[model samples]
Target: MANTREIKNRIESVQQTRKITNAMYLIASTKLRKARNDLANTRPYFDALRGEIKRVFRTAGDVDSPYFYPPDNNTPLEGTYGCLVITADKGLAGVYNQNVIKEAEKLLAQHPDTKLYVVGEYGRRYFDQHRIPIEHSFLYTAQNPTLDRAREISALLLDGFLTGTLKEIFVVYTDMESSLLSEAKSTRLLPFHRMQFTPPAKEKAVQEPFEFYPSVGAVLNSMIPSYVSGFLYSALLDSFCSEQNARMTAMDAANQNAEELLSALRLQYNRVRQAAITQEITEISAGAAAQRRTFGSEG
Candidate 1:
């Protein structure tokens, strides 16, 4: 049992800690809400870009577009794949970073020869711990993500895909479903999937040929990269929001625990002080009684 003095000091410390944790939790909760709204607003644009490119691929060229179709099956086994792993720069969220790292590890194991690209410090640390060779990595993405960062990352992946250095490129990240739920997702970024979106069965391409200002190929080249940018941006946004939510959730738990500890300490402090006072009172009363008896007997 700790002395009242020591326990009192501990109670004060925990109170201070609780205050800080509460503040952090509130801030994180607010940020998570905002991030979700931001991502939702841009989802339509991303969808439109994706739909436009896929539709273009269906009718773009007389010959098959190289980007639309799969290349030789043997190429993937022989060609290196670039994996972009997204994880928190710092981790406090429950299992968010861990889940992403696990998924990335599984993806990496599928390819014996791969060019690993690490995006954040956490992911980089994970690969280093596993002794996986990282061919390229970026460590400077802002705590609050930006579109330019996504563009740069997308461009790098596109370059690898075009150069034949990487037959496939994938982004492994956490997809934010909500404050409490974020799922790890591994998605292939290139070569772009050609999904054909056609008009209604009653309508035909000949009935209403969509006009391309330059050409479908040219239009697709621009839109596809934009679509990629949006996807990567969404991942980063999801991760940032998830990190905040996790931190907030953890801090809230810590704060509650601290409050409980403080309550226990206060109760003990009061009991100990009351016991000391009662003991002093009993001793004084007994001493006075003994003096009264001694004096009376002597007289």
Candidate 2:
């Protein structure tokens, strides 16, 4: 059994830790709320952008645009696969970063000729430490996702796609289903797949015959980049929200564990203190009895 002083110190240490964890939990909660709001607010615009792209693909038939359909099945997979990995900049987010990295690793292992384009400091540092080759690294972009930032990343990716450097592109990120549930997922971003677009019976294409100012291909070229940026930006926001949610959950658990530890330490301290006091009382009683006997004998 530890002495009262030792147990008291342990209790104080746990209390301090509890305070830190509680503060972190509160911080994460606030950030999570903001991230959720931002994600929700941008979702509509993202959906509209995707809808417009799909509509364009549906309207423009037999246009030899690479962005309209998936890569040719007959074409052998020979080019390097580009993977954009999204992770958090800091730790203390539980398994948030690890899960996404593991997902990316699995995908990369399947394709030996792959290049990593990491977003966030954590992923970049992790890959560098592991001696993995990084094609490009973007830092400090995941937390505050914006159109401009997304555009920058899109430009790089689009250039690679246009140059045939990246045969296929995919984004590995954490998809947040809810506050308590999130899963790391890999989504193909390039070699755009054809999605079946259904329109309302009331809204017919003949009723709204659209004419392109320059050409359909020119319009598509502009729309494709914007659409890609929006998609990537949405992924960034989802990842940010997931990171906050994970951190909040982890901190809440840590705070609870600290409370339990503090309770046990306090109980130990009380037991040790009571034992010391009882021993002191026993010694005092024995000394008094001996003194009283000696005095009576002498008298």
Candidate 3:
């Protein structure tokens, strides 16, 4: 007994929604491919940096580099540690945003009350909803992501650690092994192993002690910051690509769900309309038989 006008209106509305979801799906797919390729291209650069770090550690002298500090328990844990959680700005993938949000939640659960550094608008909103504190936020657009901007953010995080404002720094980001496989991981940003500085367990003769032009400490001073910045930037890029891939997958699933829903609704609408028509025909036939009997009796 549904109104015909209401059914028509609903169908039109669903059709419009279907169009929008379809368009978004297409857009996400295109962006996903671009991001995936971009991330792949950036890998060699990261590998080169890794090689440079290994090489630098090999030649470093007796002087203790700031980057090579050991995590001492007795160092007196003062001040708070902040976590940087990187997630995508938009949501459409099935459970993509939810899974990341859950990861953030778990991170927060470990720390009684830790501040959040978020890279996406969606993450900020999620923190706000959960009563989590957000210390800093950076939102990026799809068209352009600047390395300088990423470096600036990384510098802030490192400065906080250096100045004792933030006791320790941890970054939670999605690692993109492949388009199909993405994982959220947390890693300490600083205090790399000095012992293992000279690449791991390959029987090459240890080179002679490294000589510094200015000072080894001074060289460490410059390179440590760059190393931190470069590594963070690379991680962010990987997460960025993962975000796009996650979104693309999510949107694809959403588009499919929407299509399935439309199909179901359409079927329901047809069945209801057909039943309504059949009932009308039954009423008409009944009325005609009743009229014929009345007419024959009158005659």
Reference-based lDDT, residue 260, model 2:
83
Sorted on lDDT, best first, the list reads 2, 1, 3
lDDT of 3 by residue, 1-299 (tens): 56666777777887788788778767766876776666667667757767766666556535465556553422424458778877767666556556667777786777655668888777888888877778988766423445686688778887887777777677887777876898888776655656545656674644676567687677666777776776777677777777767766766666677788778778878888888899999999999999999999999
Q: Report the Cα lDDT for candidate 2.
A: 0.83
Error of 2 at 107 (Å): 1.1
Better of 1 and 3 by lDDT: 1
Query: Tens digit of lDDT per residue, candidate 2, span 1-299?
Result: 67988888888888888889889889878887887787788779868976886576557654456654543453435778899999998899899999999999999899979899999999998999999999999865567877688889899998998899988889999999977689999998877655433345455564365687688778877887888898888888889888989998899899889988888888888888999999999999999999999999999
Which regions of candidate 2 deviate over 4 angstroms?
A: 70-76, 196-208
Candidate 1 C-alpha RMSD relative to the actual structure:
3.0
Model 1 misses residue 283 by how many Å?
2.4
Ranking by TM-score: 2, 1, 3
| Per-residue lDDT value at 135 in model 3 | 91
Q: Write the per-residue lDDT of candidate 1 for residues 153-226, one digit (tens) a residue.
A: 88888888777788888888887676567788888776654334333455445435678767666666667678
